[model samples]
Target: MPEPDPNVRLSNAEREALIARLQTATEEGRLDLHEFAERSREVYEARTYADVERLLTDLPAEDRALAVPRAPAASGDMVLEPSYTHLKRQGAWIVPGLIRVNPKYSRVTLDFRTAEFTTREVEIAVNLEYAGLKVILPKGAHAIDDGVILEGGQVINRAFTPGGGQRIRLTGRVLYSRLKVRYERRFLWWRW
Candidate 1:
């Protein structure tokens, strides 16, 4: 296959796809955290194909599979209603750009270990009344919790890092409920 025009301007979706590939490379140990961070910043700032391509020149070609396009979900929002049931989102599901968790008298758990993110940044909005929400993220995932509003509830965050890997922004209100954010290493045997 002929190589794409390096000078061609990249679209938003194309930039996001490249970022996803970089994230996968980081997770696969093909690139270190520092390299991933540097490349990610370059990806976002890249205006042409060559700018983005230069960042991935050292990465293996297999990482291109991570950029394959997928069908969009019916709804990007995840809602939990008033019930005693527990809602969990894990595995190879696509991580939406915006996730809404509004549960009354229920528990919601969102695990982003193996989830595929189409964007470099993900925003999760939580609004719980008399419910509980626990978000589990991979170790390198960076979290921001400044937008959370707690009313008669407590939020325990163990995953708030300023400049980590993929960015996750948590925002919403919790009334008479509990919200916890924690992180776990992707591989138990490997430590970076």
Candidate 2:
């Protein structure tokens, strides 16, 4: 697979691989426990491939190689299935035209506040079970709750407009879960 664009989002496996390298560095006496703990938090909080790479910039090239980003799936569509861990997609990562989120008993967040969109109109098909999905759209972006069958589930749209910079159509089923679409709270005061 070719190297992914630096703006691509890092997967859970990729984050784990980077952390594994950090663990190795700690064992090799290259990093102290304090540094390891700090870096580990940054790794988990990282969103884009560039963020992951930045964490290993001070390390040796051999260790940095473990942070190499992988290209998107050949299918073009992005599929997110987080079982237990929290899945967050934020920062400068590129958003595909189509995204299918199928989470089981996990909390998933797709924050597009500073993300790059490949398409003007994006479709998010969320099929969630016993999990919650929150989508934070960028400013001027509009979201439309097209058709999402709910079985004891709730869909909250706090940032849905008819037309705007980008259009997001939500579709699929939610069983005993919650789907929330809202804009980021600006300055911790207003939701814009």
Candidate 3:
């Protein structure tokens, strides 16, 4: 089989086309990163919609650089999925760590007793009594618990690592209320 042109960068027009397709699916909560990457890589080799995935699979590793995060430059009502890779711009590089929480349950509370940010520690205290739920979810949390306790913050601290990143606290009532609540989040530790 013929390899694709390595020198060819995706044209702005082509990138726009792909972005449009991805945006449509993302709005519907359908274009996940894995799917987006696969379809995008296929665009170079695709002869037909049905053949797109095959092109994606056949490409060399170098072809994968086409998947760039389209945020900041992306305009209007579109919240792009958070980037998991480290980013560098203007000679500065940023790496993301994890989240830290109390009790270490799948679900958590948000009403912080006192929410503060420090280079060493961060805290979000919540009144467990009125809280229906609370979860310290980062963007694209991937945790799929219907009643996972959390707050709805469009933006979160992406630079922090989840497991040991931040910390939260709740009163005794919060503990009891969370007793029956179940959370189903899978992370790297789960594999080990």
Candidate 4:
């Protein structure tokens, strides 16, 4: 099929389809909530066919209605999938905008105390089964766990409240697992 011209005007139906693709990517842990909102805004503001196509370049096409082909690989997502192992991320690490965690029979720790965040809002998509996941937020950072679905699981938050600071949103399913959100304890000369 011939590639659509970049300057071709976009129809309302095409715009809606692009937005739907963004929503699907968010649900699949490819895009965070903040990213979704931003891209949705772009979709509404988009005028040309290329404008809409740019938003979906990194996402796969699950439906044939779009007709346009996607790039072979999707970027900008960090996935952590482990089974029967222990994974820890701390210190000076770079936190991407989206993190997808799927762990089974494992223990995972994500400490954002000294890490660098590329965006003010981050989303952690967790799909857990028989696992233990601990997230240590930086001081003054807010966290929301409202989007998580628990099936014989727990989502515990020993962290900051919603206020003027960085925000982290957790989503996805937790089956027979435990997800804990807390802050790093600070001492006089060290952190715990």
lDDT of 3 by residue, 1-192 (tens): 344355545443344444445545544566665776666556644443344324334334434323433322322221122223211111111111222223322233332212222323222232233223443333322222222244331112322333543332222224333422112245876810
Per-residue lDDT of candidate 2, residues 63-118 (tens digit): 76343444433337887876765778776667789999999999999999887788
- Model 1 scores worst on lDDT over the 10 consecutive residues at 65-74
TM-score of each: 0.57, 0.64, 0.22, 0.60
Which residue pairs show collisions in model 2? Answer: none
- Model 2 TM-score relative to the real fold: 0.64
Candidate 1 residue pairs in backbone clash: none
Question: What value does the lDDT take at residue 139 in candidate 1?
Answer: 62
Question: Tens digit of lDDT per residue, candidate 1, span 14-133?
Answer: 665676677678767899768977887787688887777667767777676223453434245544453566667655566778888888788998888877787788888888899998
Give the top-scoring candidate (TM-score): 2
Off by over 4 Å in 2: 1-75, 188-192
Which model is ahead, 1 or 3, in terms of TM-score?
1
Candidate 4 matches the true fold with a TM-score of 0.60
Candidate 1's C-alpha runs over 4 A off are 1-70, 185-192
Among the numbered candidates, top lDDT falls to 2
Worst 10 residues of 4 by lDDT: 64-73
Query: How far is 28's C-alpha from truth in model 2 (Å)?
Result: 25
Better of 3 and 4 by TM-score: 4
